[model samples]
Target chain A: MKWLRKDLEKYVQAKEYVDTVIIPVQMFQVVDENQLEKDSFDSEVLAIFANEIEKELSGRVMLAPAYTYVKGADLGREAERLNEWIKHLKQQPFKHIFVLTLDMQWKKSEASLDANLLWLPGLKPTNLQSQEAVQVIRGQIEQISELIRSYW
Target chain B: MAAGLLAPMIRFAIDPVLQSQEKSGDLVNVNLSVDDITDTPQRVDWEVQQVDGWYESNINRTAWVYKDENGEIVALSPICTHLGCFVSWEGSEDYPNEFYCPCHDGRYYKDGTNVPGTPPLRPLDVYEHAVENGMLYLGEPKPREGA
Candidate 1:
């Protein structure tokens, strides 16, 4: 939260304007039913985390509903899915959409997840830190602010 | 003295005539302005930005910039040390983050590091860059040492 506050402060100082935020939640089912039961705890934590992000970015930013499932899709198909979501958000008249991917698995294939988001119109992509995804999210917010300023 | 003087006069007289006959065509000098050579980035940026997908074409025989999602930044030469041809970036949609050469399908990172599977023994070349005010300046392309 300290890092998030710091990044937000920097964005405000930089006078960056953010319109919409896209938060993607990890929704994968484990093989173990016991693990699945425990995974509910993870989901609850993710829900709370999303709530915090929405609350923090409110008024200044609109929150897109979380992307619930993204586990078993080809990279191209995943990109298409993300594009659909961005199209949906564009209809809302939002100028910028921030996408948050909660992907813990760090593989070369997984890196394409962000690249897929780049295919979306006006969607600026960034990664979430394992320990502090919120801070990384805020840094992207600042970056988007800078991009908007460049246009003005 | 007589023979030497005669030889010199004969050679001087015939040299120009022979040279004129040997000339293939008229040689013309071309003067290029600095602006003409350097103003291409703005034009290329606009043109490439409008295009879709990755382009592996060469510019000025020195370097080619892969126009992916990062806009119009110039990339190093595509010629692999092991073999030569253009290298494509993000060739396989599955591994879309790396630069790949189609010949042997040599792979490289965005920063030009070569991957293990490829025949490329070296990394890609990097172009020098400078920005003056709003304009971007790219330096001459050079081969990547140990690449």
Candidate 2:
């Protein structure tokens, strides 16, 4: 479900069903012009994937705010921080925790991290407005969403 | 000094006239062509741009528009009369093109009529709509007692 007013009200009232949280892990890279374009595209692709997946699993899934931090930050430390946040959020009794990311650095902390990490490769810079590009993006998202649903 | 006094008096004179003319039952341009609606009840989510004086707001709304058996256009509200939850259109093998409410298992017919034994206390609300310049414009939804 989306992080909207209506969903939140229903979520609190019917806490049992809303047991899954999708935490988006995005990297911030603003300074380097070369990497900046890649970062922006990745963020867009990540958002589309999140929204599409949430739409499919609306009644049970809650899309959490992005767990954003600067690129090249200590992966081990970030994993600990992410775990602590997830640990606290477990008070809500979220049965499943899926970390959605495009960063490859999470591979090191994959075993230690307390959530299921679905790390995707970075997207190539493309014109989002073109019909061909949209289809390609949707097709990729569809495959990933099915993978996410298998865990459910 | 004289001009200042006259301006306030003129403004006060027109204030009541303007206050009495607060618009109601505004029609929003839904941006759908007449051909877009088919025999199948298609639910379309639209953004309504509302201008309330200096404040502007965009609100999301949902409506089901279809061509009825008699070829008349019918539009219904998505709100379930039972508990205000949004209802879904499910055409199962047993029930064809039925409006199903997930909240209480309430069921409604394609014509927005509630099945007599169902949980919905009233029929689905219908939006006041008109077609102008080949574009559909929908207005406020008016509730109806079940037939």
Candidate 3:
């Protein structure tokens, strides 16, 4: 289910059935134009991945609002902040929490994080409507969904 | 006397306009030729204007369309009945010629009927379809009763 009001209302009624949460981690920076463009594209790709994953597992997964942080922010501090979000989400007793991101910076603090960090290689910025791009994304989504299922 | 005559004249002119407006929104021309639709189910994406309270926007919708054994065209809603996940044709390596939902391994036969004991409780919904000038137009999908 998505973070939309209607979906949340349904989630409230069937919270027990939804056992997993997917948080998309996004980052952006305005200091460097080049870096900003890359981060923006990456954020778009990450959003697409998260949306497709949620659609595939809507019955069992809740797609939380994205966790966004500015680029060049201290990774240690960001990791701590993310963990606090996870800790609060855990009170809802979600059995599984998967953090999906394309930023490699999260890798450095993976061990410190409280949820399953899925750091995928950054995909080249391409028109998502192209058949080839759609195929590639679909293949990756199948793999990621399968990996999440392994936890169950 | 003049008011009574004008009322019928206005109603005759306005009624056709209202009726045509309703008919125009009834079916979406998917832009795919009927002949192009083969035996295999092809995912067709189309857009329709949706009005939600005060907001109106174009919403993207998808359907799995194919020709049945009798050469009749069939359009099925891709949404899985079990958990509302999108189901793909032959998605699973082990399940060929069937709609597979990756969410919980829900499977449906080529005819849109759910495989017994699968996660899906009902068959895939069938879209109301019509072929006009060799072009396929689809309407809202309706729930099926039984196999």
Candidate 4:
């Protein structure tokens, strides 16, 4: 992970480029009772993954702290948690912030729920096998970049 | 005798200051030593020997690195030509490789060129680089044409 950070700086220095940070949020599904014997996703595991990502993006990109929630759980609680997270991010020095839902169902469609959340920012509703999710994420990045440019 | 002695004393007192000022005009040569660059799956940091003006000034040099849709390493400058604000790598969660500026919302590609219809009519700057003895040396950055 440290090496990744170093590589990022190298590339930035070598090419003289700047960029916003990308943070991925993952929602883990609890294993069924019959499948409990198999490996299951947990918040701790997600934290470890987030930590690794933070290391890789240390200097080149800002890694937002990861928030883990249960899949198919209480929508109200999920929305509350997300709103709180966005509020917290607003205090940071980041130029732009994003929220990757990580295959969760919060059911809140309106972007204005939390006026401070910066317009739902971006969402990664699912982690399906198709690369559609990646493309969606990419498109959003392009749009945001354009928006930033319009001001310049 | 007192006046003659005072004249010699005045000349002696001024000679060293004049000599010191002349010496100050000499040019000092600076040699910058290059250091090795290491890479990892996430981020990258490096250390190199100091050079002239390196410690006293903020260097505006920056670079963008990301894997394209094909997963190739794409590196470019992060400077926005519109106002020179450093652009972020990811503006929205949906766009990972797109360069974004929060100051004015300027947008650029992974290659550091501005997107059409955007405020930035030019691309980001680029730094010259070379690998020597397993070390990477970055030269000064040059603004992209029309940027």
Candidate 5:
């Protein structure tokens, strides 16, 4: 289910069905214009993936609000803070938590993270409306959703 | 102070009616050629302006639309009845001419009826549709009784 009021109301009633949560990790820095555009694009793609994943697994997963942190922050501290969010959400009885991001830096500290880290390779700035791009996104969504189902 | 307290209460009571008028029972032109829709179900996508509380945005919707044996247009909501996953046309080679939901192997027959014993308990919802000047316009999907 989405992290919206109506869905949350449904979630409250059927909390037993939702066993998974997806937390999108986004990083942005406004200081550098070039870096800012790239970061924004990456975050947008990550959001798209998270939204699609939630739709595919709507019966079993809840999409949490994005976890946004300033870019270029200390990785150790950031992961520690992210863990706190996971710790709190786990109390909701979500047996599975998937942390999705395009930033590869998290890969280095994946072992220290509390949830499953799903890192996608950085994508070039391309038109998402194009048919080819939409097809690629659909294919990736199918694969990623199937991978998530494997854990069940 | 008296007006302020009653104003909020009145707005709360009237909010749902206002919201429903804006979002539901509207026809969206899908901009697909009616002739292109054949016996095989094809995915049609359209966007609608939606208002959710303070947030307003265009929401993309998908439906599996095709022509039945009688040549009447039929548009079925792609959402699986069991879990809301989008169903695709003939997604599995083994299930020829069937709507298959990869999420749990849910299947619906050509007329949007759920294949008995599949994961889906109810038949797919049918969209209210009309053909105007060769352009297909569709409204919200309504749940129908399954065999």
Candidate 6:
């Protein structure tokens, strides 16, 4: 489900049926001049993958808006903030909260974070419209969707 | 004072008669072509602008239209008789050529009759339909007897 007014209305009525929330934790920081291209490409790939996962299991899953952070931001504070978001979402009594991210920095702060952090390997900047890129993304979506279902 | 109190109660009792009554429906014109529908049930989604006095709304409608055994036009409601979830036309390995509801694995035959042992005890509802100049127009959905 999208993060829009219309969808939020539907979510309110079907909150119990939709128990899982997928949050894309995107990192917008570029450490150096050379890292700029990679950071943007990685974020795009994460969005593509997360969007596909949401589409596959849309009936029971809610796609929360992405949580973005700079590379040099305080990890401890960000973790706390993320937890606050999760706590608020729990008012809906969500059973599963997954933070899908491409940033490995979250790995160190995972212990304090309330949501489950799933860090995936970042991909090189490739043409997303190409058949190879789409095929790879689709494969990952199928695997991730199956993993999420296993939790239920 | 007693007549004043009794008069309000009497007015409440006769309120139905004093109020004007009317039956109205927002029948929409769906642009689906009748020729496109065949023995194979096809899923069609249409939208209609519903107007009720002062309130105006647009709603989406779904139906599976096809020809029955005698080649009569049939438009079946896409809703599952169990819980109102949208059902899709089955073209799969398990349930081939039937209406399948993913919510509870409910299945309905080509004739909109629910298969035995499914959660849906009643057959799928049928849509009131009419054809004009090759276009199929759908109306209110009414319940049908259980298969």
Clashing pairs in 1: A22-A98, B65-B75, B88-B100, B122-B147, B123-B147
Q: Pick the candidate with the highest lDDT.
A: 3
Report the lDDT tens digits of candidate 2 across residue range B1-147. 999989867866865323222332366667788888899888766767778778897656789898898877787998877656566677234566798764345789998899789777799998877766777777777899876
lDDT (10s digit) by residue, model 4, range A11-123: 44533222333344555565666532221433333343344333323333444555565555666666677677667645644345444332424325325335212122333
lDDT of 4 at A36: 29
Candidate 4: RMSD over Cα atoms? 16.2
- lDDT (tens digit, per residue) of candidate 6 on B1-147: 999899867875874222211112334457788888798888676777789778897655778888888977888887777655557788334998888765446789888899999878899888777666777777778798877
Candidate lDDT (C-alpha), each: 0.46, 0.77, 0.87, 0.46, 0.86, 0.78
Clashes of 5: 0
User: Model 5 TM-score?
Assistant: 0.79
Give the Cα-based TM-score of candidate 6 against the true structure: 0.56
Fnat of every candidate, listed in order? 0.00, 0.00, 0.56, 0.00, 0.44, 0.00
Candidate 6 residue spans exceeding 4 A from truth: B1-147
lDDT of 2 by residue, A84-143 (tens): 878977889898899999888897789988899988886678886566876676678657
Structure candidate 6, residue pairs in collision: none
Task: Report clash pairs, candidate 2.
Answer: A1-A61
- Candidate 5 local lDDT, A17-126, one digit each (tens): 67889999999788988688788999889988999888878877889999988888999999999999999998888899999999999999999999999998867889
**Chain A TM-score, candidate 4?**
0.43
> Number of the top candidate by DockQ?
3
Chain A TM-score of model 3 versus the true structure? 0.97
- Sorting all predicted structures by lDDT, with the top scorer first, yields 3, 5, 6, 2, 4, 1
Residue B30 alpha-carbon offset, candidate 5, angstroms: 2.2
What docking class should model 5 receive? acceptable
TM-score: model 2 vs. ground truth: 0.63
lDDT: the better of candidates 3 and 5: 3
Best-to-worst order by TM-score is 5, 3, 2, 6, 4, 1
The per-candidate count of clashes, in order, stands at 5, 1, 0, 44, 0, 0
Q: Write the per-residue lDDT of candidate 6 for residues A38-141, one digit (tens) a residue.
A: 98999998998787777656656788999988877998999989999999889887899999998898899999989888888887788977768866886787
TM-scores of the candidates, chain A only: 0.50, 0.91, 0.97, 0.43, 0.97, 0.94
